[model samples]
Target: MNLESPKVTLDKSTEETFNFLSDVKNFESLMPENISKFEVLEEDKFLFALKGMPEIILKKKEAIPNNKIVLGAAGGKLDFSLVADITEVATDKSEVQLTFNGEFNAMMAMMIKGPISKFIETLATNMKTTV
Candidate 1:
């Protein structure tokens, strides 16, 4: 599996950050608003209805409050897992780190990284505002 981990610091309390990030709906809102249709399978899962390489629906198979969340995707040309953890640095600051570990060929890995990075950046931006 190829691994890519990125961290983003936000000016928000741990509780406040968790309060927003812990909710699946908030995460969906952070996604590209242009996605034509979106389906949320549960409190921590959603499907992205768009056309793209290795395009596959994603589901939040696991989540731990204020700590970690995991998402699974399988279909199209990809099968992968996205996991993220949140850590508190102070009363009004926190750091969110995400690790992408999955079994995908190098070519596919390179293709998916750009969009996924942007998506995560968007998540950080949105969380910054919400928290």
Candidate 2:
């Protein structure tokens, strides 16, 4: 497992941002089509169909409106969750902060860190575009 955190501020209202973030299908739409496929499961969890990626699946374990969400994946043979928070910054802006924390075996740590970081960065960028 690897711990990774990435975040961004969006120039949109909290309600608008929360609405967009609350829907898992929106993430599928925002992701680059060439890189992966996304499938939404019940209760806001999802399975990420990634190509040329080591992890076969990614899951969103928890999501709360306008506050936080947690996603997990078995990367490099270790299970890890990346938690993220969305908070109101002002009347027309919101901030997102991602923090990673999980148990990682020694072997899995190095391999998962960079890619997960990149994924979080991409998520922030894509979310901004959507907002």
User: Each prediction's TM-score against the native?
Assistant: 0.74, 0.77
Q: CA lDDT of 51 in candidate 1?
A: 46
List, residue by residue over 1-131, the lDDT tens digit for candidate 2.
Answer: 44444567889876778777676677776564556666666556666655787434556677777788777774446566767688899989998876767676666667767776776677777777777
Specify the highest-TM-score model's number.
Answer: 2
Task: State the C-alpha lDDT per candidate.
Answer: 0.67, 0.69
Specify the poorest-scoring 10-residue window by lDDT in model 2: 49-58
